[model samples]
Target: MKNLLLIFFIITLIACNQSVNKISLDIRVDGMSCSHSCAPFIKRKLIKTEGVLEAEVSYEKKLAEIVFNSSAISKEEIVKKIESIADGIYKASIIKASTKETNLKKPSSLNNRESLDFNLTKPGISHSSGFQLPNLFSLLNSILK
Candidate 1:
């Protein structure tokens, strides 16, 4: 029974690590008229997409930053998804793409009236809140030992 429990914990930790294929993509969006409706509209659609973990759209900068699991979806598919919104009113192009080892912290719920503030500019800055999966795994490993 003890051996079985140890194996289960190891498997769980491996599975958690393998599932996170987080990719951060910066996209340039065209044809947004205002920050009020256009930005939120695009943000809502992007967040609803499968494999999309987070999306931040700014009409003032005409930029959309999205974080998703590449294993579940491709960047090209995301760009196409954007272009297909609102009867093709928006055009999207990838500005930059980078792979992230961990997920970024974001609000659990966003108000329609509130705007997202992007503060993830500095390198090596993590805004993760609460206990993360990796930390849990580490604790389990220590306990098992």
Candidate 2:
């Protein structure tokens, strides 16, 4: 009975990890003269993608916001999808990608607000602020020396 329960628990964990999770992405799309050529087309293409759940393109802002299922596709595939269409008229680069929990109560008007959710899972040397600043006092001491 204990062995059966353990097997069930392991299966549940694997299923959760393999679930079709949704992720939101912010992309800076270049190479389009939004006024004359490509914003609407790009938005349409993204919406038509197999795993894309939602897409919002802003011509004036040069931003392509997308929500997609990660299990069905990857971020690299999304970038490639844009570059492969329309003689390569649109080029997209990711600015941010996140899997933040969706807020059911938040108003639609506040959906696209900026956030600073940084993931620290990779192997690297990290500082408190993630960057170093010059010490003004050290500079003054050097001048005196």
Candidate 3:
């Protein structure tokens, strides 16, 4: 019985480790109007990133299908790099994963109003409470006075 259980555990571990991972990413980017001209650059950059074994780009669909080692890389990293290259160019969908898990959604910015659901009191700003710095002329006048 113990031997059978051990065998099952080993099999499970192997399955998890060797599982295939593929991510479907939509790259809505500028400066890439033509696939013939830009496909190679996209492919090269993606391939350089960790765990990416293959990157296939479709010009018509503007989609990038990437096969990678999930243990080494993540969907978020890919999206971040794509966005960094040419602002707002990455939308990732995890078609498959070796671990069968999803990553937590992180806020894009600290001041994202839409995602702010925390309870907080609203404070009013007063005109008199605003910044008031004495001018150089005023300083001179005060000294003269």
Candidate 4:
């Protein structure tokens, strides 16, 4: 019985595997004076946002580079998420955002779907939040100062 279940699970993982489409966002954020203090705050928020796969913020450049699923989230929505943080204190302006579908060939056989390169996550935040992350700009300001 265990062997049968394991085989079924393995087959399910194999059947569901497919190429992914990715979108990249480059945003220039205003009202940030320091990178170390502000960028982390921005990154923490973006990573928590729905549809965001990976996000990097550079305070020195006042820019945010985010990778996400365009089909699931739009550029406008991403900007809204950014601005929503700190009660609209951070002004986010888009420099450019583009998307492309990846067309890599599927491997002849996948022994383990878990071993494949995957940074995917479900879109949106859960009610529990899983962990607490700081989103305070005033305290950050005081610490930086």
**TM-scores of the candidates in the order shown:** 0.62, 0.55, 0.42, 0.56
- lDDT per residue as tens, model 4, 81-144: 8888888889998998777522222331211122223423456732332223222343335556
Question: Tens digits of per-residue lDDT for model 1 on 1-145?
Answer: 9999998888776657655578999999999988789988898888767667677888988998888778768999999999999999999999989986333335533322122345553789665422224335554676779
Output the number of the TM-score-best candidate: 1
**Top lDDT model:** 1
Cα lDDT tens digits, model 2, 1-145, are: 9999896576555445544578988889888785645876786777667666667777787887887778667999999998888998788899989997332223222222111134443579442421222333444466569
Give residue 90's error in model 3 in angstroms: 6.3
Lowest-lDDT window of 10 residues in candidate 4?
A: 108-117
State the lDDT of candidate 3 residue by residue for 1-145, as single tens digits: 9999896576555444454454434444344577775655566677666556556655666666665555556777776766565455544444443433223222222122221343233466322211222233433455569
Where in model 4 is the C-alpha error above 4 Å? Answer: 1-19, 100-145
Q: Specify the poorest-scoring 10-residue window by lDDT in model 1.
A: 108-117
- By TM-score, the better pick of 2 and 4 is 4
- C-alpha lDDT of all candidate models, in order: 0.75, 0.67, 0.50, 0.65
What residue runs in model 1 are displaced by over 4 Å at the alpha carbon?
1-18, 101-108, 111-145
TM-score of 1: 0.62
